[model samples]
Target chain A: MIRLEGLTRRFNGRTAVDGLTFRVREGEIFGLLGPNGAGKTTTVRMLCCLIRPSEGRAFVGGYEVGREAMKIREIVGLLPESPGLYGELSAYRNLDFYARLYGVPKQRREENIERFLKMMDLWDRRNDPVGSFSKGMQQKIAIARSMVHDPKVLFLDEPTAALAPDSAKVVRDFILELKHEKRTIFICTHNLYEAERICDRVAIINTKLITLGSPSQLQREFGSGKTEVQIKNLGSRILHAVKKVKGVLKVEVSGNKLLIQSKDPETVNPRVVEAIVKNGGKILYVTRGAHGLEEAYLKLVGKNEV
Target chain B: MRFDRVWEIAKKDMASVRRHRYVLYGLVVMPLIFAIVVPMITILPFLSAEVAGDNLPPFAPPGFSVKQATILAMVSLLSLIFMFIPAFVPSVIASYTFVGEKINKQLEPLLATPTTDSELLLGKALGAFLPAVGVTFASFTGMVILVDLLTLPIFGYPVLPDLLSLVILFVYCPLIAILSVSVSVFISSKVNDVRAATQLSGVSVLPVLGFYFLFLGGLLKLDWVELALFAALLVLIDAGLFYLSKMTFQREEILTKWK
Candidate 1:
C-alpha cells in the first residue's frame, strides 16, 4: 500500500529524514521504531503529502507523493502527532467539518460521526467544544476524526502519546481492529512495546534502518545465551570438571557458583551436572538461559557493542 | 472540495465568528464608533459654523462644497475601510486558517485529505473576506444614514451622496478588501503565529493610507471619472494578488517551514 525509495527531507542544512526506503503491504501493520528526533514525523508528513520530500520518491495507494498527493489523500487517513483541533468547535462539528472536506456524502455523515464518536466513548461530549476536553479526550477525538472517512490506509504518528493507560489501550485495540479490517497502517512511535504488540513486522530506524524483522527474529539475532549453574560447594574444582563436558564452550567459577556457556544446552546440561556430582561437587540449581527482546533492541541500537 | 464547498466553509467560519461575541463586538462595534460617532463629533463644529455663517471656512479647502459635503463625508468615512474594516484582519483569519489548525493539530488531517490547495485557499479567502467586507459595508451604511438624518435640517441639504460615493463603496471597497485578504492569506501561509500574521498583514493598510493622503492633498482626485478608473485598477491588482498568493502557497512548505 505504501512504497518509498530513497525518500529524504532536509531543513536548512540539517537532514530531517535521510534516504528512507521501505514498503508496507496492503493489510499489514508496519511499525516505524526510532528514538526521538529520528525523523519519524518528517517521514509521515512526506507520505501524507503535507510536505514534499527533498529527494527520492514515495507512493501511497499507487499515487506518487509529490505529483499525485491529492489522489493519495483520498485513500489515506492521517493522525498527526499533535492533536490539531478547533477548540471552539464541538466534537461533532469537528468530525462533521472534516467529513465535508473529505466529501463524504451528507447522507452518511451523521451515521459516521455517531459511530466514531461512540467508539471513542466521546458521544456524550459530542456537543461540547473540543477546547474543554482533556488532552486524552482530545487525542481520542483526533483519532475519531482520522477515522471519520474510513480511508484505506492510516498513517498514525504517535497515536498513543500522552494518553492514560486505559485510553492508550483503547487506541491500541482500535489499531488492532483496523489491522483485522485489512487496512494498511504505518505507525511512527518511540514506544517499542506498543509496536511489539500490534505490528506484524517492525523496522528500527536509528541514524537509518539498523534492523527490520519480527520481534522473535530480532531477539534471536542479537540475544546471547549464557547458562548460570550453581553448585553448593563446587569451588574451582567443579568449574574445571564442567569445562571438560562436550559442547561446553566456557566456564567460570566464583565461590560455589559456576557460570557456563554451552552451544547446545539440551545436549550438555545433563553431562555437566553428572560430571560435577561424580567429582564430589554438590549440585544446587541450574536454569536454561533466555534471550530477551529488550537486549536485542539495545544491541541493535548500539547501546552495547557486545 | 470545490469552490462551492469553500462557501460552505465560509458560512461555518461566519457561525464561529458569531459565537465569539467579544470578537464580533470588537470587529463591528468598535469600528462603528470610530466610523460614525467620531466623524459626527468632528463634523459637528463645521455644521454649526455653516449654520452661523461665521466666516464660513472652506469645508474642504476650495473644491469641496456642501453639495459635495456628502462625498467628502463618505470619503472621510472611507478611513474606516482601513481603520476598522481590517484589511489586515484577513491576515489574522488567513493565519488562523491553517496555522491555527496546526497549533490545534487539525491541519495535518485536513491537508491529508483530497482537498487541494486551491480549494483550501478559496475556503480561507471567503471566510476572511466575507466578514471583513460585511463589517465594513454595514458600518459605512449605518454611519451614512445616522449622519444624513441627524444633520439634514442643519445643513439644509440631504447629504446628497452622489454616484461617486456609491461607486467607491461598492466597487473600490471590495477591490481593496480582496487585495487585503489575498495578501494576508499569503503571509498567514508563511507564519505560524496568528498575531505575527496579523501584525505583518496590518502593513497592507499602508498603501490605502498613502492613497487617502494623496486624495486629501488634492494630488489624486475622486471625481466620478477618476473613481471609476481607480476601481478598475484595484480589481486588476486584486486579481494579481490572488494569483501571487496561490503561487507562493505550498502545503509542504506550510507544514514544515512554518514551524
Candidate 2:
C-alpha cells in the first residue's frame, strides 16, 4: 500500500533519510526500527505528505507524493511522535474536531468519536479535558483520534512510547485488531519487542535501509546459527553424537542443555534431534539458540544499546 | 478552498480560545477599558464643567458652543482610539491559535488534513477576526450609550453615532482586525513562543496609535476626506500584510523550521 524508491530527505545539507527503498503491502504491519536520528519520522512524514522528499519518489495508496498529497492525506492517518492533542478540549471534542477536518458527516463524526473513545476504554472520561488524563490515556485518545476517520493506512510513530505496560498492551492489541481489519499499519518504534510482536515485517534503518525481513528471517540472517536443545537426561555421549552430524559447525554443552551451531538449522536440527534421541537423551524442547530478534536487530543496526 | 473546512477550523479555534485565560483576558479586559473606563475618564470632565457658551475653539466645526465642541472633539478623537481595540485584541487570540498550537505540536496533525493552505489560513484568520471585531462593536455600543447619557443634560443631544463613530466602528475596526490577525499570523510563523509572537504583534498597533496621537495633538484633522484617505491606506497595508502572512505560512516550514 506504500512504495518508496530511493526516497531521501535532507535538512540544510544534512541527510535525515537517504535512499530508502521499501514496500509495505496491504494489510501488512510494517515496523521501522532505528535509533535516534535514524530518519524514521522523516520517512513517515514523507509518506503522509507532511513534508516533501528531497530526492527520489514515493506513492501512498497509489497517490504520488508531492503531486497528489491531498489524496494521500485523505487516505492515511498519522499518530505523530507526540500526541499533539488540544489539551484544553475534551477527548470527544478533540476527536470530533479531527473528524470534521477529515470531512466526516455530522452523524458519522459523532458515531466515530463515540466508537473510538469506547474502544480506548475512555468513554467514561470523554467529557474531561485531555490535559487532565494520564499520559497513557492521552496516548489512547491520540490513537483514537488518528483512527476516527478509519483511513486505509495508519502511520504511527512510537505508538506506545508513553504508555505503562498494561496500557501499552491495550494499544498493541488495538493495533493487532486494526491489522485483522486489513488496514496497512506502518509503525516507527524503538521498542523492538513490541515491533517483533506486532509487525509482520520490519526494516532496520540508520540513514539507509540496513536490513528488511520478517523477525525470524532477520534472526537467521544476522544471528549466530545455533540450535538449542534441552534434554532431561544429560549425557556427554549425546553431545558427542550431535557434534558429528553434518552441518554441525560447533557444539557446547551446558547443564541439562546443548547449544549446537550450524550453518543451516532447518536441515541440521532434525539430525541433531535424532542424534540426541538415538543416544538415549530424552529431548524436552528444541529451539533456535539466538537471543531472539533483539540480538539480530542490534547486530544489523550495529548498535550495542537501544 | 472549502469554506466548510475553514469554518470548522474557525469553530474549533474559537472553542479552544475560550478556555485560554490569557486570551480571555484580552477579549474581556481590553474592550472594557475602551468602552467603559476610557469614556468615563474622557467625558466626565466635560459633564462637570460650567457652561462656557459661544467661546468655541477654532478647530471645532461651525455650529457648536465651546463646551459642546470640546465634548465632541474629545469624543471624536477618542473614537479613533477604538480602532486600536480591534488591532490589539486579535493579536491575543492569534498568538494562542498559531504559536501556542505550534509549540504544542498541534499543527502537525492539522497540516496532515485534506484542507488546503488557504483554507487553513482563512479559517484561523476568521477565528481571530470575528471575536476581535465582535468585542470592538460591543464596546463601541457601550461607549456610545455611556458618552451620550453623560453629555445629554448639557448639550440636549446625543454626542455619538456621529460620522466619526460610524466610520471608526464599521470601517476602521474591521480593517484593523484584519491587519492585526494578518500581522499576528506572520509573527506566529517566525516565532515559536506565544509570548514572543504576542509581544511582536503588539507593535502592529503602533500605526493606529500614531494616528490617534496625531489627531489628539492637533497635528492631524478629522475631516471626511482625510479619514477616507487613511482608511484606504489601512486597507492597502492590511492587504500587503495578509499576502505576506500567507506567503510565510507554508506547511512545510511550520513543520520543519518552527523548532
Candidate 3:
C-alpha cells in the first residue's frame, strides 16, 4: 500500500536519502533494513509525509506524498523513531488525545483507548503518568497511541529497538496480529533477525536499495558456491590432493582436518569425499555454507562503507 | 478543526504546568511582585508617615501632583506592563508551550496528525496566550483593588484604571504575548534546545524596555493619541512578525536541520 519512486532527501550538501525506490504490498510486512545514518528513517519520513522529499514522490494508501499529505496522515499511523509522547499525561490520556486528533468518535474514543491499552497489556498502568513508565512500557504506550485510530498503513521506525526480549516479542506479536487484520506495515529497523522472521520480503539498503527480495531469494542471488565438508581424519598431503580436484579452488588444514573452498560444491564435495575414502580418510559431516541474510547485509553495507 | 482535540492538547499542557509547581509559582511570582509588592511599597511610606515624621521624599513624581494615590496606582500599572508582565509571558507561556514541547519531542505526534498547520499553530497559541492574558488581567484587577483599598483614606479617592491603562491591558499585552509566542514557536521549530529558544524569544522585550525608559524619562507620554498610535504600531509589528514566522516555518527543515 506504499510506493516510493526515486525518493531523495538532502540536507545542505549531504544526501540523507538518495534516489530510493520501493513498494510495499497490501497485507505484507516490508522491512527497510539499513545501518545507522543509512537513510532508513529519512525514507520512512518521506513516505509518511512528515517531510517533503527533495527529488521524488511517495504514495501511501493511494495518496500522493506532498499533494495529499493530509489525506495520507488520516489513513497512515506513524510511530516515530523516538517515542514522541507527552510524558506529563497518563497513558490513557495520551491515547485519548490522539484518538480525538484522528477524529475517532466521542462514543468510541474510550473504547478504542481501552482496547489498545489492553492489547499492549498496559491497562493497569493506564492512569499513571507516562513519565514514570519504563522505556519498554513507554514504547508500549506509543504503540497503543499509534493504533488507537486503526489506520490502514502503519509506519513503525525501530519498533522493537531497546526493548527487552519479552517486550520485543510482545511488539512482534502485535505487529503480526496487525498483518493478520490486513493492515500494511513498513518496519524500518537494524535488527536483521527480527526482520528476517517477520518481513514477507526484505530490502537491503546501504547507500541505496542494493537488493529487494525474500530472504531466500537474496541468499541464493548473493551466495557463493562455498561448502563445508568435515572429515574425521585427513593428512595435509591428502588435503592438498583434494584441492587439485575439479572445481576445488582452495584448501586449509588443521590437525586431522580439511576445509575445502570451491566454486562448484556439487562436483567438488563428492570428489573430495571419494579422494578421502580412497586415501583411507574418514568422513564425518558434509554441508553447504550458503550465506545467510546477516552475511548478505554485512556484504552489502560493507561494500558501501565509506 | 476538532475543538475537542485542541481542548485536549490545551488541557494537557495546563495539567503539565500544574505538575511543575515551581513553574506555576514562577508564573505568578512576577505578577505578585508588581501587583502586590510594588503597591504595598508605595503605601508603606504613607502608613509610616506618622512614625517617620515626614522624612521621606514625596512618593509621587515631581511635576505630576494629581495625588499620591493616583501616583501609586499609575506606577504599579506601568510597572505591570513594562517589567512584570513581559518577564511573566515569556517564561510561563512561550517556553512551556512551544520550546519546551519541542525539546521534549512532544511536537512530532502533534504535527503527524491530520490537523492543519494553522490549527496546530492556533492551538498552541491558545494554550499559551489565553492563560497569559488571563493571569495578567487577573493581576491588573487585583492591583487596582489593592491600591484602591490602601489609598482610600490618604488621598480621598479610590485608585482607578485610566482609559490608557485599560487599553494597555486589553490590547497591548495581548499583542505582546502573541508576538512572544509566535517568535518562540518559530525559534523552537528551528532549534533543538528549549533554553535557546526561550532565551532567543525573550529578546522581543527589549523594545518594550526602550519605550518604558522613554516614558519614564518624561520624553514620551501616554496621551490618548500617542497611546493609540503606539497601539497601532505594536499591532502592525505583531502581524508582520507573525507573517514572517508562518513563512519561515519549514516543516522539512524541522524534520532534518533541527539536528
Ten-residue region with minimum lDDT total, candidate 1 chain B: B52-61
User: What TM-score does model 2 achieve against the real structure?
Assistant: 0.94
Query: What would the per-residue lDDT of candidate 3 be over residues A38-125, giving only the tens digit for each residue?
Result: 8888787778778898898888999999999999999988888778788878898889888988998977888888888999999999
- Clash totals, every prediction: 5, 0, 0
Cα shift from native, residue A257, model 3 (Å): 14
Winning model by DockQ: 2
Question: How close is chain A of candidate 2 to the true chain A, as a TM-score?
Answer: 0.91
Going through the candidates in order, what fraction of the true interface contacts does each contain? 0.80, 0.85, 0.71
Give the chain A TM-score for each candidate.
0.78, 0.91, 0.80
1 or 3, greater by TM-score: 3
Residues B24-65, model 3: lDDT tens digits? 786778678767887777665554354332332333344433
Better of 1 and 3 by DockQ: 1
Docking class for candidate 3:
medium
Q: Which segments of model 1 are wrong by more than 4 Å? A: A225-291, A303-306, B16-22, B51-88, B154-161, B189-192
Identify the superior model by lDDT, candidate 1 or candidate 2.
2
Preferred candidate (TM-score higher): 2 or 3: 2
> Considering DockQ, where higher is better, how would the candidates rank from best to worst?
2, 1, 3
Error of 1 at A295 (Å): 2.8
User: Looking at the true structure's interface, with contacts defined as alpha carbon pairs within 8 Å between chains A and B, what fraction does model 3 recover?
Assistant: 0.71
> What RMSD, rounded to one decimal, does every model reach?
5.4, 2.5, 5.1
